[model samples]
Target: MRIDKYLWCIRYYKTRSIATKACKEGKIRVNGDSVKPSRDVYPTDKITVRKNQVNYELIVLDTPKSRLGAKLVDIYRKDVTPQETLQKLDLLKYSKEYYRKRGMGRPTKKDRRDIDDWFDTPESPENKDDSEE
Candidate 1:
């Protein structure tokens, strides 16, 4: 199976197009080498997927006939991603909490405009040029 299709089948990506795009962008690698979208995949191949600041490592177990569900994904690939990497994702989540609370959704238009205005405003007296000596 193609690497992109395998990734999609194993549920590494939401869609085959996204998987193919990631391969085109060189975000997917096999056995320590970057692979193209059409690259062939086989059992026991070491696959690495870089997404959202994480490098996920997986070993191909078998090729699925089609996209698998979340529970059935383990039958196709064995995830070997380090525990530290997952901890980092947790830390990143905490860091982002300082900026926005949970369930807040995206910033509203007025809020974005206010933030832009705040940054665009003049610094202060030092930034002003009112010297009349």
Candidate 2:
């Protein structure tokens, strides 16, 4: 099976097109080497997918005739992704949750203040004295 089709079949990606695009972007690797969407996938091929700040590792078990059910997905591949890898995703999510959503326009006054506070530094003694003068 093609790499993209295999990924979709195993439910790694929602659509084959998305899998293909990810492959084209070099987000998918086979046996530690990057592969193209058209790359052939065979049993026991180790796949590494970089998605959402996580590196998901999978060992292909068999090829599927078509997209498998959620419950049947385990029969096609074995997930070997590290726990820390998944944990990082959680940390990243929670860290970004406090930020404003994209396309929401410019920051508000409070947001600006928060940003300023985050970047604000204390003035040196010389600079402080100069300002006082």
Question: TM-score for each prediction?
Answer: 0.76, 0.73
Best by lDDT: 2
Given candidate 1, what's the lDDT at residue 21?
99
Task: State the C-alpha lDDT per candidate.
Answer: 0.91, 0.92
Shift in Å, residue 118, candidate 1: 25
Clashing pairs in 1: none
Could you give candidate 2's per-residue lDDT for residues 1-133 as a string of tens digits? 8999999988889999999999999999999998999999999999999998789999999999999899999988899999989999999988886676754779888888988999888878999889889
TM-score of 1: 0.76
Question: For residues 1-133, what per-residue lDDT tens digits would candidate 1 score against the true structure?
Answer: 9999999988878899999999999999999999899999999999999998999999999899988888999988899999999899998888988887744879878888987998897657764656533
Deviating ranges (above 4 Å) for candidate 2? 100-133
